[model samples]
Target: MLIRILFFLAFLFLIDWYSFQAFKASFPGNFWVKLAFWSFSIIVYLFVAYTFLTFSNRGVSSPNFGRMASLLILSIIPKLIILTFLFGEDILRVSTGAFQSIAGSREGDFLPDRRKFLNQTALALAAIPFVGILHGVLIGKYRYRVIRHTLEFDDLPEEFDGFTITQISDIHSGSFDDRKKLEYGVDLINQQGSDVILFTGDLVNNRSEEMEPWIETFKKLHAPLGKYSILGNHDYGDYMSWPSQEAKAANLQHLFQIQEELGFKLLRNESVQIQKGNSSIDLIGVENWGKGFAQYGDLAKAAANLTKESFKILMSHDPSHFDEEVKSFAHHIHLTLSGHTHGMQFGIEIPGFIKWSPASLRYPKWAGLYEELGRYLHVNRGFGFLAFPGRVGIWPEITVLELRRK
Candidate 1:
């Protein structure tokens, strides 16, 4: 771990050095101007190092420190972009020299100095991502988009036709910095007026205490039928080191209690029957089940009393569960809701045009809707940001799924 940290810092320094070179070439000025630029660069470097060390000493549990670290790291993105252009120019210069030498033509020098236009152009281009990332951190992270999808299912219960279900996931409460912004998101969820509200998982980052400040805000959310939730990988406190097993168990119990306080029925490998008139549908929820993460969910146990004829909606945190277990189960799960990916909190999505994110490389069903074997899975982009403390193209999401009988 220590070696990895050292390597990371060294890499960051190299990028910073190249970025400084670009700055020097692009803006050659008086001593004061040079001092100012160098000072700013040095401060950023020192701050990043200090923040990481402080967070590491604190066991890296505090979300504020994590956010600070993220912001620091993000500040370097523009510099890296600038360096890319600078390095590309250098490669072109070298190639030109090689070709000229092969032709027996003597040049003024083996390699030319950095081009001013190229450096300036790189600086200009770097501003795009720099401003974009700033905007993402300031405004995009709280931009709650309500994505609605009406899914038609032949096996759906007639009574549940047009049943509206609002789903949100990956609410990393520990990372929230603004209460008013969070309240607005909760209000938006309430505004949907769906029949049921379903939270896929990740109520908190790692501990139950993180949700204490936002409990009342979430409790305001309402649904006519009910509100249901299942644990995500983060809610289990698996990422942190607990002093004792009993303490860890207690933390989980408190999290469950917090869920109840917020009017969410915490479903741990269990199923509930929702009734309407003479008809009923099964809402089965399992614990955090992912391919590479924790696997505490029992699909069979959750569907114990239900049969193949049951019209079921399964709530599992990770979308991978659908591929790994749910779809191949004996009973047909009509719809599965998940939200562990958060669309990577960055991506491009143009309706009817394109939807792409780096997260797709890992989780094939990263966001939006997917269907296989006539079964559907809806992956919510997530309600809150994590790790990065901000979002880019993929804004926070509030998903409303309407079930229809075909």
Candidate 2:
């Protein structure tokens, strides 16, 4: 927990530094500009903070309010100090260079008049909050758009052609207190012309009862090949307060019962055949496989009763499963589907720079669809959030994959 909190702070610092640099680069050097930048930034921060803090304690006493106000002041003081240390220099250099280029009306660098530069820097600080809020909305509300794109596999076997798989991952139902939202997502899924649907795990977060309210809504999802599901890291009754091992076992059993209630065929180290006209392909699903998490996915176990000649599509939640476990499995899975990485909830994708979120740096195929070694893997950005409780650029996903014959 301490490590996670530290990481979050470090991430915020990086964002502030980058934004400061960009702001500095865009403005012209002037005293008024610099003063306005800094003063406006201070005011924006204080205003937002005051608004939140004021409303945060609605029925508090005057004494309580005094203490809370002191605490708020203390907190902002440290953040201001930290912000200067973290971003002060980077902002100056980037801003000066930017102002010179803008003044000259070309892409060249030169130092700005120090006094004027400082003034502009302060003004730019005002713009910072606006930019920060914008960045927050872009990353939080739209991050998934970059990673969530419609994929068409032109070489899919004819048997599975046009097989649109409406995938939802990392539902984390425990975090969702509203049934109406779940129903909306479900309704959207049902409306998509999907021939088959795959739910790549993390269905109920930690407990079976978390999904109880949405069982009827989820059951409404029906396709010709039906809805199939696999387990994700959170599905194994981990990260919870259980009375005993027996209680955990009972929870898992109840989870299976919920899957049955929701009309989803739970795939646990097993294979099923989906028939189409005269040909059929194997749909295999395995237990979650992730590094340092559950290492229970057995490729051989999933293929035990299936033929080696079968055209296979495997649903395994973690993308790491494909890169590590299934990439070289003997049966040669032609297509693998997964989700788990929500694209770090931030990033930019452009012509020369696909500055995807830092999360992708840790996991190479962290988002979107990719192919390697003659096998295809599509990683869904996910339909929900976990710790942050909101997406940035990576929004909730509704993937519709079109499979075409080779």
Candidate 3:
């Protein structure tokens, strides 16, 4: 723990030093100006370091502390970006001086101190990410978008041909800061008028109590068919320490009860038949399952009663499950919905022109739709932010999937 703290403080100091170098280059030969800049930089660094230490000691149980700490980390991202460009300039300057000296040029004739244009350019480039992050924290986090997709299936039941499903995942209620904004998002979900609502999980960060404040707000979500849900890794209370195994068990029980109270039929490796007239489709839901995370999901058990001809729609928390197991199952799981990646809660997405997130490198099917061998997986970007306390290019998502018969 002490080593970890030292490393964190060192990292902050490095960022501060680099920021000072960049600033000094821009306003060189002004002793008072440089002193002022140094004082301001050190003050901010010390404050952030102190906050980090306090939060580390106090624990992450409080949502406010978590938000503050996340914001502080985010604050360094712009400085780091600026530092990269400034460091490159410094390297070039050093190389030029070394080459001149080797060629017998005097010290005074070597490369000049620091190019003002280069420093200005660095600051200008850094502003882009700084402003982007500010927007993410202030606006993008609550900018809920309803992304619609039409998926066709040759074997879709005639009665359920035009069925619509609205999916919202990774609620992480603990990170929410505004109730009014959350209510607006909830209203947007209801506005979709989806036949059924499917929530792939998270719900809370580490404890069931995180959801207590938002129960009534989420309860307002209505679907004519039903609302079904399954757990995400976060819902298991595995990230936090408990006094005893029994206490952890009780916390999970309370989470289950909270889901029930919110009118969500929690499915734990279970299947439910949704009927429309004479046609019916099987909806299978499994507990949280991922590559390195928990593997509580039982695909076979969930699809046990369903026949090979059953048109199945699966709700699993992580998209990794689709790649690892669901597609290879005996019965063809026609469509799988998941949302654990949250697009890494950061990335660039532009309709059809481009869609990219760092999350894709880890989980191949990080966001949107992916198809393989006639099986489909739609990974929702997520409905809430987590450790980052905000989102950048990847805004909170509300997915409306319209099922059509091919």
Number of the top lDDT candidate: 3
Estimate the lDDT of model 3.
Answer: 0.88
Instruction: Report the candidate with higher lDDT, 1 versus 2.
Output: 1
- lDDT by residue (1-406, candidate 3, tens digit) is 5567678768877887777777787877889967875675566556656655666422454555556555565567778888888789889998988899889997695775788888888878887887888788889899999999999999999998889999999999988889999999999999999999999999998889989999999999999999999999999888877889999999999999999999999999999999899889999999998999999999999988889998999999999999899999999999999999989878898986989999979988899998999999999999998877778899999999999998
Model 2 residue runs over 4 Å out of place are 1-157, 177-179, 350-355
What does the lDDT read for residue 130 in candidate 3?
Answer: 77
The better candidate by lDDT, 2 or 3, is 3
Q: What are the runs in model 3 whose C-alpha is more than 4 Å off?
A: 29-44, 55-65
lDDT of 2 by residue, 255-308 (tens): 999988888898999989888888888899989898767777887888999877
Sort the candidates on lDDT, descending order.
3, 1, 2
Alpha carbon deviation, residue 231, candidate 1 (Å): 0.4
Model 3 TM-score, 2 decimals = 0.94
Question: What's the lDDT for residue 286 in model 3?
Answer: 98
